[model samples]
Target chain A: MTVYSNCHVITFNYRQSGIMERIYLDNNATTIVDPAVRDTMEPFYCHMYGNPNSLHLFGIEVRPYLHQAMEQLYSGIGASDADDIIINSCATEGNNTVILGFYFNLLKDTRKKHIITTQLEHPCVRESCRFLERHGVKVTYLAPDRDGLITAKMVKDAITDQTALVSVMWANNETGIILPIEEISKVCKEQGVYLHSDAVQAIGKVKVDLQKVRVDFLTFSAHKFHGPKGVGGLYIRDGLNLPPLLHGGEQMGGHRAGTVNVAGTVAMGKAIELANASLDFENREVRRLRDKLEDALLKNADVLVVGKRELRTPNTLYVSIRGVEGESMIWDLNQNGIAASTGSACASESLEASPILTAIGADRELAHTGVRFSLSRFTTEKEIDITIEVANKAIERLRQLSTSY
Target chain B: MAKSDLIGGELWEQYSQRVADRMNNPRNFGELTESDAQKLGGRLVIADEGAESCGDTVRLFWIVDEKTNIIKKATFKSFGCGTAIAATDMMAEMCIGRTVDEAAKITNLEVEHALRDQEDVAAVPPQKMHCSVMAYEVIKRATSIYRNVDISTLAETDIVCECARVSLQTIEDAIRINDLKTVQEITDYTKAGAFCKSCIQPGGHEKRDIYIVDILARVRAEIERERNPHRTLSAEFAKLSVIKQFKAIESVLDEHIRPVLARDGGGIELEDIQPGENGIINVHIRYQGSCKGCAGNVAGTLSFVEQTLQKNLSENIRGVVV
Candidate 1:
């Protein structure tokens, strides 16, 4: 299958047919951009080609649209100032700049190289911590609450003068458990620690009020919120010293230098706006689908649903079908037209347990068998019914194959 | 799977359909439970030793309804991967309400050839086969977490799903209770019949799979193991028979896999490689500081060491360290 990326969102034209043909359910891995978001990106590719960083009328005229996009995003997430939003490649780079840069800057004043994070932070964060640890820097990985929630208390207890930063996620990707960011930010404030939250999964799913929560930094990708894959934004508090991850040019306030992903940034802004606009209504709708799918799998198939019961991103549902291989089940479902994920899209090819799954203490089998089906507002009832029918057949078949005993 | 001798067309068609009848009609899916298992449980599958005694007399599926903390729905189908016909036939007949979480811990290893235990009532498959059995066990543990909802309600709603098992609750539960960290454990729970079973070794499987250059690499492992037959195969070694002959290579390797590497400007530090159902071994070699990023590290060190050991050891080891 060929997947085309426009304005960063990957939209696919699937042409398989069958009652057995598959339907994709793993949107948590990525998403198809809203049609309207795509339309907004069209004009920029063909018409608005002037560089915002260039001189003369052409550059000056294009600059406001870019700033408008920035402003639209800030307003959407409840950030008070647009200046603090630094657009960059996805959250990975943002996470790297904030986390690594914070450490580099901290090293200037104190050799106290320490980072405290949740065990479930995204790989960008987890790996950075691992890399730093290799350099003799200390990092304390805070564990999440049972059911995968990261508690402020966990963060509070892990801090010391040695800690350069506290990094956590606003919502978990695998289980969709929303963390108590406001409370955790408050704790960080009280303790005088800088806090960085990888809000990638939580961006469009939950409301993030940078001003209200008062975190030192917030990192997220646009595609997760319906933007593009490579486009994302980072929220750094005003007057914060953020050294550039790339050093060249005056782009992104010198914090991140490179030719701006013009169409991508604009599209991401639109995606964020769309998400904020439809969040509440879509929440109830997709969550209804989530609950329905979860209930059906539980009732008919030997399946289990994962994620926080009440406080989680509305679309994600993680379940395991007992006595079946996830890979076989995935292949079987795909043969019939169901597209879903065993774990994060970034790491789907791997059979390893998602770090988030491990953080909440899921065992190896469950972690391996985990199938994440995330619903979007456009998902239909017929698709769900088909999923149930297909799931019932495929799960039973695969389970039969695994019955070695 | 037997060659059909019933040449009368109509009669054969009728017989085939008759057999398919047993597998028809939404057989052996599952549900959660309500009562807290006296000793911790959710849903289950309990298969009694058929004419054969496979250790799995029972496979339990479990999940808690977050709302009630009660097991939601619990059900089981007798597991028999091989006796596809007889196993399912017996499973449908035998399993119903056993709730020991361990009962569901059966793996594909135990199911080898389905009716392996049609006679022996208490025979456990090899300890190594447990990972296969444990794959289902992991799924059973994962399935137990679905007590949070009711199925009838979902069909009427709009949740579009795509996973064959579209549910991870049971697997998540297993992880929570078992404290499993690696993909091996999760894969075992799901019984995904590892495409490559090298990950779940007793030691570390940080890399996915290693690639040995040629038959020489295979020979080198034999030579290395033949050299040190006493070097313990990981606890998860699935087949001990072929693994048994590695002493010649083991001694050679302890005497060699590294000496050859050290001979170059580089050095080799051996990391544990797990042996799976197939005789494939997974290994890692660490190069000393200056030689770290050298391009031929894999070929020069890994290949040379592997080739020497396998070639010198004769039939001591199977596939490359990968």
Candidate 2:
């Protein structure tokens, strides 16, 4: 009877999944696991469940697949075979490891006790810098310009002889503004300081070639590109040694120590391969849909889009619809079976305005009204059309209700 | 996908059915024009209030019958979150068909309760409770405009919780009527200390001489003394020497009042104390620091000082600002 009930539930969900027309535009938060990635990861769960550290035949069979996944990860980020790619749990963990590793390994012994990062960093990087500050490290948080660009000159001006590292994000998660990381990396190289870029938003949507961009450390997550959650990669350049964040078994050459997540690593490998293959489609098709949605939203005079279309990633649209609160707009969108976000999902519950918008010099009122709609390659034109219609209706109704009008 | 699928499963459950329904379709939305008011044989009263904490605002429209003093029609427009819209919708609905005096008596708790799916269940989450308080405030503004009086004249007692409009009299009445003991019970009944929570105790975002903690202690002590009728502390203040009386009053001001004023860069200094007719003790105070030239020193702050002194040291003490 239990098996029968389980089958009934599965059949019910399958039928509902095919018929429901839910529109998802919050891809920057996370993405659905692709069917191809899921298929590639299925065998490691039960059939080939062997600990990669064992010397038995069962473990020997898993070695080639693990090596292949590692190779895929190395090639995906354009890292050479000599460079080390440490697979860990998500970009947040990777970011913490790199920032804290600089303090624990290099800066602790040297006279250089300062680090420079931008105000536009993810909370993980920002809070990690703050944590280091409590431990007697001087940190400079450079603010972005009105265009939401953190220039290379800002990094050069903030750099000093005591500067040990410079960290910046490749693309902002809120405004979709890509920072000038190439020039910043060049400046860091000239200043004899290590450079790290949180390329979580740039890896799948844009072309990120580590060969051309000489960043010392780069981090990315597979889930941002349609892989499973709880798995990501951190790239360390050749001839650089940072102490391990997690200490236990000798895994990933002791750079990061843990039993390998075989299924998640395989899924990430497959997802990155697919993401690389779909780069052209992402630029052409996803960009077109995002532009269409932006054009539709711009028809209203009260709407203000955050960044220029030519400057941002192809999939993100962050806008502030005046006289409508972000949470209220998201509530209306969710009622219509459409998903969106405001600033960050983690900070949405607080009544405080978006810190990102405030950092970009937006007024307090405009900062309270930011709504983000991030697209994926799977987002259809019909979904965009429905979203446009629903969003317009919500704006009109909410504006009529607003006394400011 | 279901609504739970769009929002997370846990957050989706926070919205009650009635709140969601009213947010989607607010029945009492939009304003009444002057011609519409004239058509209903009443005068239009428009009142708007804004919440500085979240930049949410609500504007209320009422057409009061001149002779009968009844609200002929009521509507509102809210520039806020979904919970604000639902709260203002219910607040405006409760005003219609009731006299202006009766409508003015409506509280945020009543508006919040009217939006609930069940009797005991809350309509909105705790963080959104301030939206209903905004709704209740706009009604007071509209009432004051219709009656041609100041909004402050409508409240008979001091405000204990500025965020939720829970006054000292309202909280005391709620505690006495409902037999409330805990601070959570006071919040659940009167919505005091629900938002910001600076009024709950000292060392919060703001300071208050008469915190909910102090009020609970005073009320419980009064209840205990009432049961034991022979016990009294009223004559203790009159029996003290002049120097001891001055020290006693200074100590009470130091412990209870100075911290609240000092938090906002203001303070009060005791100028003099003298005996007045009818057994009254006149305590003269001069504003120091940021309190000088401030308008609240004449009204709210002065009364709060007197009330704190009366509750703590003696009931015969009166505060005089010099």
The reply for model 2, stretches above 4 Å from the true place, is: A1-20, A107-110, A344-347, B1-9, B155-322
Docking class of 1: incorrect
Whole-model lDDT, model 2: 0.84
Q: Write down the C-alpha DockQ for each prediction.
A: 0.04, 0.19
Give candidate 1's iRMS in Å, 1 decimal. 18.1
> Quick one: best TM-score, which candidate?
2
Please write out the lDDT profile of model 2 over residues B1-322, one tens digit for every residue. Answer: 4643455333335557777778778999998999999899999999989866556789999999999999989999888887788889999999999999999999987887787766766666555675577888899999999999999998646889866777788988887778778898999888788765768898654456579988888887777667643334446787788788899989989999999999999999999989988778899999999999998889999999999988777788899999
> Candidate 1 local accuracy as lDDT?
0.59
Estimate the TM-score of every prediction. Answer: 0.58, 0.77
Report the C-alpha displacement of residue A199, candidate 2, in angstroms: 1.2
lDDT of 1 by residue, A1-405 (tens): 011111111112123333633465777778888788888778777788778888978677668778779988889777877348889988999999887897678844686677898888888998988887887788898877667777888888888888778898898877788889999889989988898999888877778877678888888888887777789888888778888888999988787889888888888888998998888866888888888888888895456777656887888887866665454455445546678766521123222446676667654446546677888877788889888887888776756544431
Candidate 1 Cα deviation (angstroms), residue B98: 38
What is the TM-score (0 to 1) of candidate 2? Answer: 0.77
In terms of TM-score, how similar is model 1 to the real structure?
Answer: 0.58
